[model samples]
Target: MTQEAHVTQGPLTTEAGAPVADNQNSETAGVGGPVLVQDQLLLEKLAHFNRERIPERVVHARGAGAYGTFTVTADVTPYTRAAFLSEAGKQTEVFLRFSTVAGNLGAADAVRDPRGFALKFYTEEGNYDLVGNNTPVFFIRDAIKFPDFIHTQKRDPYTGSTEPDNVWDFWSLSPESTHQVTWLFGDRGIPASYRHMDGFGSHTYQWNNAAGEVFWVKYHFKTDQGIKNLTAEEADVLAGQDPDSHQRDLREAIERGEFPSWTVGVQIMPAADAAAYRFNPFDLTKVWPHADYPVIEIGKLELNRNPRNIFAEVEQSIFSPAHFVPGIGPSPDKMLQGRLFAYGDAHRYRVGINADHLPVNRPHATEARTNSRDGFLYDGRHGGAKNYEPNSFGGPQQTGRPLWQPVDGLTGGTGNHPTPLHAEDNDFVQAGNLYRLMTEAEKERLIANLAGAISQVSRADIADRAIGNFANADADFGKRLEAAVRELRG
Candidate 1:
């Protein structure tokens, strides 16, 4: 058979390139009879459809993403030698995903939960992923408690609904969650939109200059739209009306040319200052007050383009804390260290082994060659190079860049210790400070919100314990929450 006779320029085809005939109808014994077994297209379509969906993320599953550009407005080369931040006014391609942390795939976007602010930067060195949340601090500092913390936020096994009792029980027992719980019950719990929320690389990271000088750093992506949030009433109403309020708001705003933006800033603390800091700098549950380490303006990030395909680009898109370029590295932050493994593992399980080879996740600004080859859906095109290194055949080799300096000493035996190294690292101080900073109206709202949730707990002991946590935050705070709960119950 000649090539021209067997192949046609255009037509719907099967996997083998055989033209699909009669796609509208299946091959049948007769018009009114049973279908024939020869209907390969029907079987193929059914099989593909059955396996269309992969597992949704265990957390931050409901999300919206957009393509954007990050333009460096200030020179940060003195602090970090990352090629993307090497020069002022340099623009890097970026993709940003905004999400609700505790929500299911079908959950309302306006729920009162921490929002995720993840970014993937396509730079010359490779792709750098900043997987962070909108809040400056998290509920738990250590990664070991992550699964337990998340379980509290999820549905009750018996009821299949989120239980306030479970949530309160966990937070009350885990005093380290006090700071973040305070933030959650505050007015800002429900952000007005993804555009108005500020993002933070909550964990401390390591940044080194071209001279091998290392500095501890944290990122703050302050929303240019300003911090706007929905009140409890507003969020509740929006949740009932439009489950996808946030997703729709972002997509429509970008389409209308009102692109949202953020001012990128970094709080750079000298490596030597970390040990002497008032609080543990690497603690995910705490934040560095602006009075101490002020944020330095570094860049502006603007989301100008909506994704063309939500599933292929946004749903399948992956981000990880381990994806670092030269000059930028991880710190001893416990949560971050665990994420360095967890995020990549989740991506492999949910998006396939070669998830990075996908168009949305692939490195665009530089060539990505790796010894990693041949997995499920291995779509990368690695030109005939040997998959293994140390070969006479010329292939891509390791970089000549200087390796990161290792830690000078190690202390403490490996077992789950309830307390951290810092003697003054009690969880209540910061949470109390936060409460004292709030205005009367904000405090009233916080009390009301906290009471409303705690009031629903069927367990009186759990509710009382939660009230104690509030009291520990502030005598006034605890009294108000206790009063509110009593009044509501009565």
Candidate 2:
């Protein structure tokens, strides 16, 4: 049989932009035998198909993103000299990615998980990324335990599935997880949609003003759509019915012109205040009481456009808390400190060294002038320009100004040391306060939710240890949890 030479240009092309001769059928060995390896089209298609996916993030594997604008509403010059936040009414382009912390790329959307709220501001100075979560606190304060905590949330080595024993055992052993664990088992754990929940820059960060005066800041993005959540039963149904429920809702809402928005606010504390604060201000597992430092409205973030390609735009996009403009810098927050290095390093490995050169990640209003030269996917944007500094040839020179003020008074010896505790740094205090603040119905729901998970553990000791942390937070909380777990397990 003679294969017809159906050669025609109809806009279908290969990766090299060459027009494809045939896409429907492969060039086979006389139409019956094994396919010919010399068929370049078949080889190309197979190779590309095999390499289509990059490694999914160890955490936050499932995500959705959109392009948006952040409009400054309040003058914050006294707080920081970051160009994007320098003047009221100033606007900056932003890309926000919402994600589930523990689920895989193919996992259902409506699960009880901490949603990643990573925002990238394409500023005039450079890109500023505020990487955070839906909750104000996290399970553990230190980054050293991060891998262990995530491991428990992931698949068990023996069973190849997430095990209740692993999760409860870790949470039980780590007392610092009480506050965040309480938050996680509450009603807000499973958000109805990304737009319906609040986002928090969970770690404390430093903001230095033009005067070189420093302040600690925490960001909050209150959803304009208002807080809405799904019960475990409702979430299970939704997950089964529509696996991409949250992602679909976000895209459809923007398409209909119902742009999702959040009122951005910041809790600012004087640099001096952090030293003698009631609790460790830099602790990732605690929240600054609103009474002590009120949240001042700063701006509004509205997502108006969805990404055209999930892989090229959303998945390839990278963020790091270290990606800051002048006046903004890291705090002593242990987790935040660790993330400053881990995030960028992960992007470099997963997305390649030239990930920043991607359209979604490149600076919007300013050119990224760096000594960084060619690597994988290098676009040759430099175009034979001088890649070195201190050259007689007017290349980009340093402004002799650091992004943030230097820390003073370092007298401690370097070793594995726990952070010095403040006046009220007990891990359970805030958790207890949170539990007490909840209404009776809310507490009931929280206890039920916690019990449902805790009861799944095979060992009674692990259940007791997990319940004990909550008990330390509040006697009533522990008692109720104990009762609920017993009933459920029976």
Candidate 3:
């Protein structure tokens, strides 16, 4: 066999961009002696290799992202003075990520789990991140329960495997999980593809107009491709056959110019209505009824480009519900309040204090000049600027108007106080209403899915408790789930 000559395209270099002398061999003390620490190349390579990967996200670790554009289709200036939505035909760049909630970084993309639908909109004012999920409601309403709920989703420390009993026990104990559990067990839990599912800002957010009037809002990104789901059997088969099926599907579709899009709509309620609303609109576990407040079309989102580098653009990209521009702010939702602090802290630890300085995460239209100075990998753009506020020197001063001022006569003690409930705040009511609203086919599928999951729980008590939760939602839902579980177990 004839051997092709090796071609040297470029010289190997260290991370610092210094030319490498000998990448293949390490310096040693004489021939065949112990390797010397003087070998900078070997030391550098080993050290970097040891720390190559950053810590994966505690949840929604597995994800795919794309570059997109968000175009204002309707005038929302009366609702929000946000520059991005100030006029029709206005467009802003966006990065959207879709992920499975209960999966590790290497887990199958086709798993039957709630999908994340996070978007970062780079507008003229600033970047606004709408961190949300595919489902309209979350499992728990309180931030205090978030850690425990996530623990249940993860593997058991003792067994090093997923524990069905642990999951069922948590769900059963936390009745607020009933609504989300119903959604999860249904066919929609396993979306056919990321493009085929809707995205929702699960918590109520505050939007203020130029006149300082506030409106509570819920965002919905309805897929233009139409809603589609995979049955458990099909999802399981696809998981085995192609673990990265969803990621591949999105990428290939964009490459073929069949760009996926979503129509952006928001359900708005008057600020005064929140005080007398039938339910707590801020509760993450509940959904705003469409009949009460219909969706108002605002914009359209379309994914037109794939990421050039997944690691830099997708993996390092960060989005937070707290990252809001002028005219938009967080509501009094306990979960959203906690997330305002938690998401940024998590990103700082996982990436670095300078994670926001990365090209993908940097504010595209504005300069971020703050007292926050150097940490690891800071870009040194803070060069010679006064790192303190209230100085005479012309540093970046606060420019934008405040979204909203603090409410007057606020009195509250810092404790684990439950959010004051309304006359219709029973956890079971909405869940039951959801079940009653479903068609017979959907109801049957929901029962089968719930049974399949509950039957896997080793503890009979846990299984019974979970069934009781379903009963609390609706008698028929409970009865059917109980029968299905018995048949499956037998």
Candidate 4:
């Protein structure tokens, strides 16, 4: 075969494929200082640049996803009355998304960041999404500071670079972030892959009963594949070699039938316990030490298949802590409250008004009937059915039958008062526990990790302030990290 290559000139086109003319330059005012307002191409380019990125997720943008199934393993109906977790051995389909916090969509997966572990359960009741993360602790305990916390993690708009000063400065000022900051510099911060890591419901949630009893609960999805991690050095090397390693691993494993599975376990506490507990249970930064509340095995989750399409199934899939089935509901964790409202708003902006209609986001078994219709990518055009409810005409009716547990009267007594700070509610305890649990080698690695990151902050005081967070976690851990950071500075 003879090959001939030539530049084929084509007609000029606009950003959306519309034909354009006069491509040389913008319509200029006398070929100098200013451009004419009539130049449509210039307007389009400027407008597009203004909105170059969809609002990046407040957190967990760098991620990978796969489809999975949750098979009921235990009889938990006596504990709570949720249909999906109703019958033992019954299976419901799920889609799981794993992601890195504090990074953009194109950022590296192994960036020494917490990984988001969000799961969507397509149940008979509705789509139940458990949006959690790899780490059980978060940097900030309150939701009010969430936006400011995220701002530090993101790029500095002025410089278009990640500024370490912004990070350490923010954390140091807000001592509440000390616990999560410690975890960020620890061993599990950079997971080897989505398959080899565990997931946690980080915030405590309320699981109510048919008899109107509310139980405080936290979920931990222990990976059957075993929790594995990459040291900072290993993670840095892997990031350069493969930025999409975790995403690829999840996809490949599911395709090969080496399905990754997790044991779904929950620690349930009676709502009354929140008052007398050693720590404030609603605090997102604290964990109920397993000794106080042991993990009870409830079910098995296995990701056996990957999404057939990335855009529709994986990318567009939205999981919010707000989305709960009957028996499950949100706790007063401030972040949880903000998210219950923010997630749906985010989906509206990024995916579209009708993103839920996408198969991955939609309830698989339970039909969605609503009066809303016709937005971008609208799949349901009301289907010739009356859009208005309360119409005498035959229309989809709200099921009067008893379904999911009601949220009324049950949570009324829970009250809106602040969670009283208890003895162990301070952020440093769990961070210290995680540090103490580390092996000597792991401890050394943690020190090295801290040194590596804190050294990048231009100001020495900022670097020292970050080390202060480690100190709060543990005196020795802080001292070791401080010494290491000093060595780097020297």
TM-score for all predictions?
Answer: 0.95, 0.97, 0.95, 0.85
Candidate 2 lDDT, tens digit per residue, 1-490?
A: 2222332334778878887778888777786878888888888888999999999898888999999999999999998999999899999999999999999999999999999999999999999999999999999888988999999999999999999999999999999999998999898999999989999999999999999999999999999999999999999999999999999999999999999999999999999888889899999999999999999999999999999889988899999999989999999899999899999999998999999999999999999999898889998888888889888787889899999988787787889989779988998999999999999999999999999999999999999999999999999999999999999988
Error of 1 at 8 (Å): 16
Could you give candidate 1's per-residue lDDT for residues 102-126 as a string of tens digits?
Answer: 8888899998899999999999989
- lDDT for each residue of candidate 4 in 395-426, tens digit (9 for 90 to 100): 77776634334334334366555545987677
CA lDDT of every candidate:
0.90, 0.93, 0.90, 0.81
Candidate 4 accuracy as TM-score: 0.85
lDDT of 3 by residue, 1-490 (tens): 2222222345778878777877777899999999998888898889989997899889889999999899999988887889889889999999999999889999999888999999999988779999999999999888888999999989999998989988999999999999999889887889999999999998899888989888999999999999999999999999999999999999999999999999999999988888789898888889988999999999999999999788888889998888988889989999999999989989998999999889889888776667888789977887888988778898767655686544445687777789879768978888899899899999999888889889999888999989998899899999999999999999
The positional error of residue 488 in candidate 4, measured at the CA in angstroms, is 1.0
Q: What does each candidate score in C-alpha RMSD?
A: 3.4, 4.0, 3.9, 6.8
Residue 251 lDDT in model 4? 85
For residue 129, model 4's alpha carbon misses the true position, in angstroms, by 0.7
Evaluation by lDDT, superior candidate among 2 and 4 = 2
Decide which is better by lDDT, 1 or 3: 1
Ranking by TM-score: 2, 1, 3, 4
Off by over 4 Å in 1: 1-10, 400-403, 417-419
What is the number of backbone collisions in each predicted candidate, taken in the order shown? 0, 0, 0, 0
When summed lDDT is taken over every stretch of 10 residues in candidate 3, the lowest stretch is 1-10
User: Clashing pairs in model 4?
Assistant: none
Top candidate (lDDT): 2
Candidate 4 regions with alpha-carbon error over 4 angstroms = 1-58, 397-419
